[model samples]
Target: MSEYYRILGVPENATAEQIKKAYRMLARKYHPDMNPAQDAAENFIRITEAYEILIGERKPPQTKSAPQWSARDIARERAKAYARMRYAEFRRRSDAFDIPMHSLLWPRWVNYFFIVFALFFITDSILPKNTIKCDFRIKHYKYFDACGKVYHLADPHTTVEGQPTGDIVYLRVTPIVGFASSYYIEGDNQNGFLHIQDSPTEYIAAMYVLLVLSVLVLRNKTKKFENKLLIKFGMCIVFVAYLFVYFIWR
Candidate 1:
């Protein structure tokens, strides 16, 4: 059998375009009409075969001059190529998936930041007792019971007979600018609210105000990451507020 590469008259490294060019040039020269000899017919067949193998509809195999792969070696190389393709596909799927570890863990990291700020607010709000003394009976109550129980009694200050009277009195204890007089009425619910000065008791009124005046800030669209961040921030605020309330009640 004639060497196909030598028939095509090209190196093993020639590309498809080069092979086609070589085949066309040879076909025109060795064509049967141009050469009447028996050997000329044989060369025509070989040239046609070479062109069919190189540039036909089916993709050609590697050049005839190239070394062939053994059965076991060919199988092993194909297996390696399949494995690389599968690995790349797996990586793409993993990147697109909503893996809880990556999605949840990262967004929760924002909570720690807000917690530090809440802690600062708490630490500043919690001040230690003053070293100085207080002058009045309630001043003693304030100094001692400020961090403990707060006593809320009924109608501590009032006015009657066109004069400020006892059981409930607004004592003007300040100079024209500087004294702190404080009292309040029990709310209609009696426990939900109390004031530091006289104010009308309308529990339903206050609830109405609370409902109308408040705004809900819910930016969390149930996105796992964003919800995690919001929950963490909420927990920090709750924890700080609880600590403050605890110290106040103590």
Candidate 2:
């Protein structure tokens, strides 16, 4: 006798849950809406039949525990069930094969967060627009803790064009135009790393520290070559962009 399990691609011993899962997956993949194969109608009928036999319908009248099935009937059902199960397993394994191992580490949003923050930070910090004695205020729809509102103070680093040094509230930024590099704010009250006269050594030291930390994080089972290249390249671009913005602001 032909095995209905083979028709639906499920295991003979498949539990109700397993059978249901397999049915749904195949149903979606080979639904009338999706599959236009020559045998699609026949295949659908086979699956429908298997489902009916396995999960028999309930009726108020003329009820039965199980169909009076023979050994041949049971054997055929088991064979069909086993076949569907193997097919489902094959699909699962095939999809698992395509994905690289390391990608499984962080969630998708985590990668997106790093990328977005990186761009925003690098852009805003390098070409700052603040000068000493500049007015800073934070406007808000309504005050949050009855304290400070969202302030738009000049980020101390943005300097006036052709007028630096001897300028009060002297500020300097690195990866200077803001592409790559940390921001430091130096004021009479707030002494940040950004100073009027920053040494090259100071910048290199900071960069090396940050880079090493990042490389360590990337040291996982699935090392994406493209990601590594992007980090290195983005850093260089940030550094150069920083210089451009720094001079432009200066």
Residue-pair clashes per candidate: 6, 25
Largest TM-score belongs to which candidate?
2
Question: lDDT (CA) for every model shown?
Answer: 0.42, 0.45
Q: Which stretches in model 1 have alpha-carbon errors above 4 Å?
A: 1-71, 89-112, 124-250
List all candidate RMSDs to the true structure: 20.3, 15.5
Candidate 1 weakest lDDT stretch, 10 residues: 209-218
Tens digit per residue, CA lDDT, model 2, 146-173: 1121211224523333112222222223
In candidate 1, which residue pairs get closer than 3 Å at backbone N, Cα or C atoms, i.e. clash? 148-250, 156-168, 157-168, 157-169, 158-168, 158-169
> Which is the leading candidate under lDDT?
2
TM-score of each: 0.24, 0.26
After superposition, candidate 2 runs with Cα above 4 Å error: 1-77, 93-98, 101-167, 178-250
Over the full model, what C-alpha lDDT does candidate 2 score relative to the true structure? 0.45
How much does candidate 1 score in TM-score?
0.24
